[model samples]
Target: MTAWRCVFADGPVDGKVVLVSGGAGAVGRYAIQFAKLGGARVIATVGNAEAAASASGAGADLVLNRHVDDLATAIAGFTGDANGRGVDRFVEVAFGANLELIVKTISPNGVVASYASDAVPEPKLPFWPLVMLDVTIRFVLVYVMPKQAHLEAAEAINSALEAKQLTHLIGRTLPLASIVEAHEAVERGDLGKTILVLP
Candidate 1:
């Protein structure tokens, strides 16, 4: 959290319009709030109204429905661009699903910070355009977290929570016995924070 907050809130996140695809999920939720805290207009995309509300409530300036036929077009609309290049930064969850559009939407010298890029499809790179604009791509790995890192993340989270600036969508809480159901619930794709009940 500290590193993310530093890299975002106190560092790269300021003065930029940031886009968060899958922005209603756990990581995205915090990312939105963190971005807002440091003064960034956030464009969040969700799968439904529930997610939209959650993201908007969490301080996203704009929310778009991912189910919309043209997700990239919607982003362009928000950026006030007919072709994209309005965004200054992007926090992407699914690169294969979103990179092509994000690349086009970002302004010159913009960056794409990717946290998770699981199976979506084969990604095609626009090497020509990227070379022209000098856009940068970064991939974040969560496994590197240490105790000190967790402490920083906790502080950032607490700061947002204390300021009443953070909002999250919690689907359900199940006891350990229902772990199977919990796993299946996660597959629903619309759920967030399926917290397990500890004894």
Candidate 2:
């Protein structure tokens, strides 16, 4: 909710073509549902078939297998265009790793809301191409968002929850005794949320 409402920080999502990278993660899954709740057509990219299934279950209109598929072509096909110009808003996770491909698939004036960029801490921006396309980049960190934005995001999330439009996906749940295991699972890149629960 915070990422969707604050990171994107744009107007209504109605009829927009929104692309979500890392669609199997907690934030990505929530973003997918939030976008759908706002009436946007969502396209999610996942690393594997299992992740793809998770994204599909979260209400993505189309799920692309990022490991094997050409993201540009996939976006083009999803948008009914041979030309790679469909994405209006992009929620990026592997921003550093996929920036070039993201730029290629996004439409003019499109916005990219990114959180993580671990792979490439210092990516060289495509100044000319981004300038030509008028793309907007927004970076979000949950802790740094303003209090008012947090309130609004909370309200938005509550509304979605009340409407039964939002649900958290738990890929694995571990007892408190297995906290180390929980961390290990996360480190191993397990799909969805890995929760450590107390009895």
Candidate 3:
């Protein structure tokens, strides 16, 4: 989130319907809340009831089971009443895994903004549809930056946070000794911040 999460504070993701793939995961939890606070509608995909509860409590508008009978139909149904025909954007955690279905579900000119990729390196991008729909694929690289710009952005974000306008959805809290297990849970899609408490 140190990188991709900035999308929210920057307002580029404001007021959009962002379909989050790992919507109940660590990043997903915060992404959901931040999007809502930013005035966007959040459609999150959770693995089960507990995750759904957590997401809803954190402010997600709709939390759907990822094991749904039909992802496309479900997504389409969710965004049916959208001001726009389909989702305005996607905060995708599994872009490669969900690319085909995302393409089928998104409206023309919709964008898939992704960050997670531990598998399937270099998958082919849908160039034609992207061009036809005028979709933009944006990547966030956090390492490269000038300190001045970073400070400016940070100041702005801090101002928003101080105003209580930017909400952060923090998930499970873990004890210091359980850090490894906590990390595992996050990788397994346990949503929210894996905070370690020191005794």
Model 3 lDDT, full chain set: 0.67
Report the C-alpha displacement of residue 146, candidate 3, in angstroms. Answer: 6.5
Q: Candidate 2 vs candidate 3: which has greater TM-score? A: 2
lDDT value for model 2: 0.84
Encode model 3's per-residue lDDT on 24-75: one tens digit a residue: 6656666676677667887877778887887787677878887764667766
For each candidate, give its TM-score against the true structure.
0.83, 0.94, 0.76
Task: Return whichever of 2 and 3 wins on lDDT.
Answer: 2
For model 1, what is the C-alpha lDDT against the true structure? 0.75
Alpha-carbon local distance difference test for all models: 0.75, 0.84, 0.67
- How would you order the candidates by TM-score, starting with the best? 2, 1, 3
lDDT of 2 at 122: 82
Off by over 4 Å in 3: 2-15, 81-85, 145-153, 164-191
Ranking of all predicted structures according to lDDT, beginning with the best and ending with the worst? 2, 1, 3
lDDT of 2 by residue, 68-146 (tens): 9987887898887556888899998888898888778888998888888889988889888888889988888878888
Candidate 3 structure, TM-score to reference: 0.76
Pairwise TM-score winner, candidates 1 and 2: 2
Worst 10 residues of 3 by lDDT: 1-10
- Looking at candidate 3, what is the lDDT of residue 63? 81
